[model samples]
Target: MESSLPSTQILDSGESAEGKNEAKNYNEVMSTLPKVKSLNGYDYYLYQGFWYAPFFLEGLMSVQEHFNPQSTDIFVASFPKTGTTWLKALTFAILTRSRLSGSTTSALLSKLPHDCVPFLEYDLAQNPSNRDLAIPLVSTHVPYSCLPKSIISASCKIIYICRDAKDAFVSLWYFLAKQRRSENVEPLPLEKSFELFCNGIANYGPYWDHLLGYWRASLEFPEKILFLTYEEMKKDTAAHVKKLAEFMGCSFTLEEEEGGEVQMIISLCSFEKLSNLEVNKNGKHRPDTSIAIQNSIYFRKGEIGDWANHLTPEMGARLDDIMDQKLKGSGLKLPR
Candidate 1:
């Protein structure tokens, strides 16, 4: 394949420019990858058999080269728009509650969930030392197949979240609409995007491949990977939080529960509470694309079965049938 990279990259930043290991050849490497049009008008690359947005590729490359995992590290993994923000907020609150001063809810005050639980393939590579490494908890949208071998071999625990295909499709379309507006490009129409989604052409997709990679992993390593669905968590968040806490080895005590700690955490991380926070409402997050997005962009209705409002019944059935085919005999079910 023809490379756009300088024939040589200082693959190791510490190495001399005159020597080998140059990784600065990102553009070169990126140009050679298999590319496809996305809902937002930019090209998505086929990386390891799945598609990913171009913006995340650079950071992900650095991550692959530099990330060193520890047994104590915890990860929250999910495909886009599958309650990732909420899961991040909940995990941040659950794990940090015992360490904060004053009220337990203080940990989440004025924070975006994305800020609290940084992305492994982006934020961590940007600042590995930002948060004190005390039981480092991070998140990733990277498919399990593409994750750094270090992470796969490490004893770290991973929690994977996914949602119903129809809802996930609707959510991603709306999300990409924001990115399209940011880029000053015409938004990919819903019908067009939905078709692409069904074909597994969105960012971080081959959606079935992304889901099954982790699903199969969670089954093989039950203790290391906890798989949860968005609908289940929403049906009973409190119970889910407890389960999350226990899985992370931080179960709330009887005294803490009696004192209303669990409920307090739930209220503080609730979508209503989070969406209204001044920080989330007005804050800006800069992605590798250098686009400053209003943190509020991440705050959507978050309602389950919302696909009905946006998609035709036939559209839903098409996706449901596709998922059924993909999930058949896998022993995993996604809400229809």
Candidate 2:
């Protein structure tokens, strides 16, 4: 099986004459964009009323100018902290199951998901290595409006998974809390963050808009996008794994399934197995970066409705009202 890892050259940092001109154009775009302070107190530029981290926007600019999407490329799209790590692990494991020998399969247990399946904007902006873009597995939290033209023009496959909006907010709140503490900054209280999130002021937020963008796209281009929900995936992970394999054009054969290949992929990527791995528990993902984060930070309590532990009745009710209003007539209602 051929690996989807990126080995293709991307014009990173605008070092060449053509690349430098592209960078100047992006710089001009950045200068005119609205900026806002995110919940973590970092500045994010607003486009279409949603906030995007500056670095991510820079990478998006690079991708727009240089990325030549192959029809076979697979992209995992989601809001931040909304089962992205889980989906990436499952997607990689499923796609690569036939490629690895039994002994080498153990490496999947050790390597972090972000290392195996890179984020399009975040990872590429930081490193600009051909390795990250060479892979078939790519991810992004960038809204549809801001995605590189090549992605849509080429009609690349996008698998978008969303969690219940309320739980997604709780997960974002907790994740940022950890990130801020690591940076020695005071984390925003849940009450305050909740208000801002509802008002659509967080990174990649107006969470409803993010979900709707992909959801509507999936409906229109069923061949190009697969929309999923975290609750639905948790309910029947094995079934969804099979669905994902088929969607990615790598369906397991009867012989493979009969040999327990599907189960093997599930076991390897399970929340319990991944969360407890030493590398995940102790490893820092790109520690040198300003947004240093632990591999374990992606684990958390991967349960449905964990938000109940944190959300007051009033808080939950307010979010529900917003979701209902925003998702009305879209045929998209999140699981409670």
State in Å the error of residue 64, model 1: 1.7
Give one digit per residue, the lDDT tens place, for model 1 in 77-167: 9998888999998888888887865443464666677877767766576556645577478899989988888898887899999999999
The residue-by-residue lDDT of candidate 2 on 1-336, one tens digit each, is 001112122235436676667666766887899887677776777866678666666666677666666667888999998999889989988877766886246556778887788777756554546444435888888888778888898778999999888899999988888877776789888988899899888778889999999999999999889999999998898899999999999999999889888888888888898899999999988676445577777778888888889999888999999989999999998776
What local distance difference test score does each model get? 0.80, 0.79
Among all windows of ten consecutive residues in candidate 1, which has the lowest summed lDDT? 1-10
TM-score of each: 0.91, 0.90
Residue pairs whose backbone atoms clash in candidate 2: 4-135, 4-136, 5-134, 5-135, 6-133, 6-134, 6-135, 7-134
Q: Give the total clashing residue pairs for model 2.
A: 8
